[model samples]
Target chain A: MKCQDVRIELLAYLNDELSSEDKVTIENHLSTCGFCAKEIVQLQKTERILKSGLESWAEVGEKVNLTEWLQEESRKLSNKEKKKEFTKGFAETKMLKHKWQKVIRFAAVALVLVMLMASYWPQLVKASTQMPWIGPLIKQLVLRDAGLSWAYEHGYMDGSLATVEQDGVKLTVLGVIADPTQTAVIYLVDGIEEDFSVYISKINGDGAASWTSPATKTSVGTIGIAQTYPLPEGEHTLTVILVEEDRDAGRRNERLSLELVTDRENISKLSISYDLDQEVTFDDISVKAKRVVYTPTQIMVEYTVIGGTGVGGAIPQEYASYLLTESGEKLYRVRSYGSHIADGVRELYEVFERPADVSNLKMVIPVQGKHQEINIEFSEPTTIGILDTDIRFAGWVHEGNMIEIEMHYEKYGRVKSITGWSVVDEGGNTEELTIWKGESFGAYENPGDFAWVTTKYELEETDRPVKLIATQVLTIVEGNWEIILPAIN
Target chain B: MTESEFMERLRPLEAYLYRMALAIVGKDDAQDVLQEALLSAFVARKQLRDPQYFRPWIKKIVARQCGKQLRNRGTVFPMGRGEEYVFDSTDKGKRPEDHLIWQVVNQLPEIYSQVVILRYLGDMSQKEIAEALGIPEGTVKSRLHKGIGKLREMLEAEKGGLANEMSGR
Candidate 1:
């Protein structure tokens, strides 16, 4: 038995639960392995030494009589009850003596409580905000997220949460929590009554363009526009194009801008230009995370997809990527923008959520570009192959001039989302197919859980016997890379 | 459950409940805590889901009473929290073997120490600990692991800070 296997059964072995054969095998393994032996010793020591601290039921149950004890307690309560009954005889005299004193004491305590609540209302808000370690005794009397709160507990928050007024209604930027797949800007709104969609219009800086989130309302008023990848360093004006939804008046677009500054001094950003030079292959594509960076905000990994295009049947076109933390926490993409350098070669930048426990950090990228041709006719359901998720062609509906090609987008593990797909007719004509966007959010809004999404596409007039080819399939390969991260001091 | 039925159910487990109270608030207040817990348990007997759940359910009330009694004692430790405050604080040298475990108790926070004591000394499972404390099983597991890890670290005496903490006034 291996050390790990032996260690798992060591507890049972100590309790004499394992079979004789398995026990002998574990004993042999323990004799050879010091680690497993020490584990058993530690477990035994903890049980033996700590048992002295407790007086168990075996000792007290026989010595103490349960029936007599209950009657005794009952007798004590009855004595107190008799004393209370006796006191009732002088109730009128006692009440007259203590009425004014009691009222004065009650009023004084109530007044003190009210004053304390009024003064510490902001501190109460800080306590509830999820910065784990900060105790209530920090003494900074501030509402929302104070600078001292983040600085003391979290150690670093580049652009700490701040409130801004848009027109008359106010919205506070809670904090920027990012991941490669979905980088959501978690925020809360105040004063505004109607529902609104918060999307980052533009972040003015180098390599700073944050899809995220088609504005998702997480808690009561907390909304985050999960911007994919990492925002560039330094101060930048974030142009938030807030779209308020009104059932009667349709939708109203309100542009509220806020200045977001990534303070480097406070943030524990270690500029480790360390290249891991590792690669994972999917079909003919060689995808590898070359450069890595860690800041107070997020962990960024720059990877490249090297695969020839139009290879047909072998190469994947599009991919949704994510990185796993040491604790196996899956950080999905909130938003990301890729730059195409050469044919079939693209350089994409993505940021993963910084690990709370960064012991064994690992990144898994399927972001493999693809091309799979499956021929489909007018009236039959077509399915894509080689992909984790089964993208099936449900049916089509006739809408005036154009027909809406309805497809059932079911998210399995591999591919997270589908932006668009191309249908090539036999006569060499291409039809423009897109995930139809309407009043309700498209496949992009909530990318993580694509449980059962009905995606409608406006198919252009195409020739018969058309080939429905998936432009991109986000299928993860068997290859995995373990990136040992430095301590985020 | 009726008052008599509640007393009947607590018959065998009263000693164990008394032990938990004794551990949390010491022997001086354990009897008071036990009486308070029994009174509240009798009053709140309706909150018990089933007859089978009476043990852990009543134990949870006992723990809460222990906490309330401790708070009422008003023994507020300061910033460093150097003073040992929990678990039979009066019985300093009851047994020779008690020193190491008591030192461990002194190091840990009240919550973590309670979980550790229940797990190791009381010989309770993580699920049982959660049931007794009225916490999620995940929280119990985390606290158990954290307590064990902290205890192991302090026992190994690898950290130089441990010497200062041990020897400091």
Candidate 2:
């Protein structure tokens, strides 16, 4: 046989499994072939060595305990049985604990329900007054048992009707007044004659005003007005005034007058309007109104409405107009609500005074719903203080919050100061500052025309000859301050 | 079987069973298989019908147990890899023949090692070896033949390494 053929059967040959004839033939070939004979000898020697080596390795496993594990498994099953019996005994205790837990949870939920009803009691009462029908249903379905508690808290109920005089007309409002924390809407009503004027204002103080005015032939009826004012913690006084006058039928007429007083607290006045002459006046009315107040906190402005000839009626053609001047510079036009004499006689008449400067504006409001022009003058400056005074720069003077420099200035030499400053890229990082109006230096109040003293500016800049500024450091009571560097400018 | 019965059956054949497990699972896991297989067999003794065939049955059980452990452990064969061959070169004074033979055997593949171990350690017949490993008798014969051939080749390579070393020195 060839060496390859013999090699393939060498294991069988070694195990003595080869047929006798084949074995004899292989032995004869091995004796003749030196390579095959040597190969066979080497293979036998290697196998013998490997076998002995592996046997020794296997002897190491002789000590392994295989049977002991079976007994342990059996013992575990019995232990599990024992645990079952023990667990059964604790079931009652667990149930008792669960019951107490449920009771505590129910108590907590009930308390939360009670607290929520108590908190919203005032709002619920107010809502009930307005929507009397749904109030009971809402409380029943929602508050459930807590409804009685809410009712007990708001047992007393009272309401009143008040008037606020605007220009010369009296506007009346009827409702339960709201406090500083609550808000309420008051509807206007004509109280005296048809087409009379009404004035509404948020009350600032408590006072009384006489409700007497002579009615003119061209004047309309009067309406109730309500004003909202702040009350610190107690009773306060509020005053109301009345005014009666005739329409300015393309000519100046006797002016209407009203007086109001408040001795108690601060009140915000919200509404003011005059009764429009419907018969002899125009129908179409349009008003162009804008928000003029531009402080970061709030924006306020006053606008006037100008109107045209009344629609086909004995109400002579009367044109209505209003003017809003800032720093003596007028800005924005006033007009009625619609355009046409047949529409209605209603003017966009509201005044606003924000901390910012406003000038060179005039708008047309139609008294008779039709065409009208709002006159505006833009040349006059409107800021009251120096344009650069109220500005504040932080990193402009120091490296971090450890040091801050507040610069304040006022307008000078007949120039209106448009004061505004922003923290722009402090140390290459943009920062924002919230402007404040406190008793701090350069604080403005009742910002007004060029002749007036206070105003807000779009940015801090100067063109005035006599600019003035006041500055102070804001120190935190518990924080440390370091002098990084003095402000450069 | 009861705990006492299990111990009685295990004590006599423990050595053989351990060796078989070592052959299959390597030294680290051989003992683990022994304990696990014994516990399982003890719990399920009623299923073992032939008492006289205990040794063969236990061997089969140990093999199956080792396979299961490997499978459970996500045992990948690490393709084309086998047990490392450790040659004892410390005995420099021994006849070079002994060292060369040792090196050759060490170089054998794991499958060849199993065959070598069964032949020498267990002293089982060819048919018994085939039955324990669940392979055909012919397959076992072929494995033995190939294993022997590889050993001879490794021995020749070892001689070459020694000669080169001596010449370099």
Candidate 3:
């Protein structure tokens, strides 16, 4: 067999899936060909490594008591089945009676409403005229229940109307609500003959902030966009600019710009602070929960990791930290970010959605007590094409279709930032790749060090040349922002 | 079959099911997945046509249950950041290398990971894996080959990294 043919069947041969003749032919090739022989050896080593690494039942089953657990589980299943059967029968009978009762009640209510409306039409109109908001109030209630209203229902302070009309397209900003965290604007669009995309380009605010364009499009010409920012206490002006890109025209129109000021009184007072200062030692590391700020939306825990490894070294494994309630329910960490606070100490902030009525909350840190570390050597860096002066491919680590390439850069060079990259196939098809920030192996410590980017693509049977394309490589620019949070009491 | 009959049939596969669950979702979620699979198997007992296919059928249910859990958690194939290999430190019988293999298998894409777990950990034949995954035997064979190739690459990469660390790089 040829080398390519032999390589393809190497796994099948090792698996003993090959026919007798094919097996013998591969054996003969292996006996003569050193490269194929080495390939077979590596394949065998991988199988052995995989089989030896898997946790067999015999190794860990003794502690589990599977038979007893199964018995208990079966009992629970039987009881649950019984309860379900009973509930199903009861619900059917109850539903029949409830259905008739609901129908009768709905009919009576409809008849009464018809009679009342016929007699009270003039009175209702007079009342609605006196209370000008009554018509919009009912519409608002209907919209709120349908999940269409966001500003007034969500305690957003109101703003004035701003309208912009251009080229038969009319855009109106109905109202707005602003707070420290987000500024929500409700807008209406009319005379849109074609589909268009709307986005907020700028939010000139006092504090550092960014705008996330609304993903949901408006089919009924009404939409809202919430721009998130750290708005300090007191009034702050948000210069909101809305841009509409018409799909058919292929042109973007700057619709309107409005300065929205936040109402200090309407801002949420639902924030509470707690100074934990609780420290727990796990193995070689000391984890301290310094403080916790609880808002209605999220709970932020600021903690520090002391004494273990330095930055870019062995950090804690991905742990699911959460707030344990008195009822033993866990609200898991939704998102987290960390930075080096001092020598041997790293400050990590974890945020979790605030659980309703959660009292006596205990912050559970992820401490594996003991960790088994498996150290593996990565392949040497392969020299790919260089992008600028010093930025180039350091090497690549891959498994199956997933490949992570390391791009090395000289410290303090002209290339200040590498934002994104892509893998282009021989067909010139480009797939954007993400930076591999895997804990142990892929993370880059310093800007001058190599950055690991990963992409997954199908490997064709025929050899196809591929190139890595780096995008948004910024030079001689500093990308930094500061957010100063007030001290929580 | 009745619930009792299903329970009796599943009893022998409990240990296998537990290990597969642990391998897929890690220790924190393994028990829940196993219980969910068992309950689902019991609930759908009437759908079982052949008693002979009980083992593979139940194993398929368990695999699907793990997939559902992974989906609900919003994680697809390939381990996310900080989700590296974590061994049960309390299991003195487990070596670091064994945990490493479990981690590697868990990190495999769901399609390949399911097949690998079923074949090796479940002691399932290729035909059994094909039946469990509702895929053709040829597809299972190809996935197994590709999965093994990926496994070899990952192992080699690790070996290279270990050598670099040992060499004081």
Residue A164, candidate 1: C-alpha displacement in angstroms: 4.9
Better of 2 and 3 by lDDT: 3
List candidate 2 segments past 4 Å from native: A18-35, A61-63, A70-489, B1-20, B27-140, B155-169
Candidate numbers, best DockQ first, in rank order: 3, 2, 1
Task: Return the top candidate by lDDT.
Answer: 3
Evaluation by DockQ, superior candidate among 2 and 3: 3
What DockQ score does model 1 reach against the true complex?
Answer: 0.06
Candidate 1 deviant stretches above 4 angstroms: A1-152, A158-167, A172-188, A205-228, A247-252, A268-273, A276-283, A294-300, A308-371, A374-489, B1-169
Say which prediction, candidate 2 or candidate 3, comes out ahead on TM-score. 3
What DockQ would you assign to candidate 3? 0.11
Interface RMSD of each: 24.6, 45.1, 13.5
Model 3 C-alpha lDDT per residue in residues A334-400, reported as the tens digit of each score: 4455546576667666665566655666666644222223222224544432234355556665443
Ranking by TM-score: 3, 1, 2
| lDDT tens digits, residue span A322-355, model 1 | 5567666666433234655677676665544455
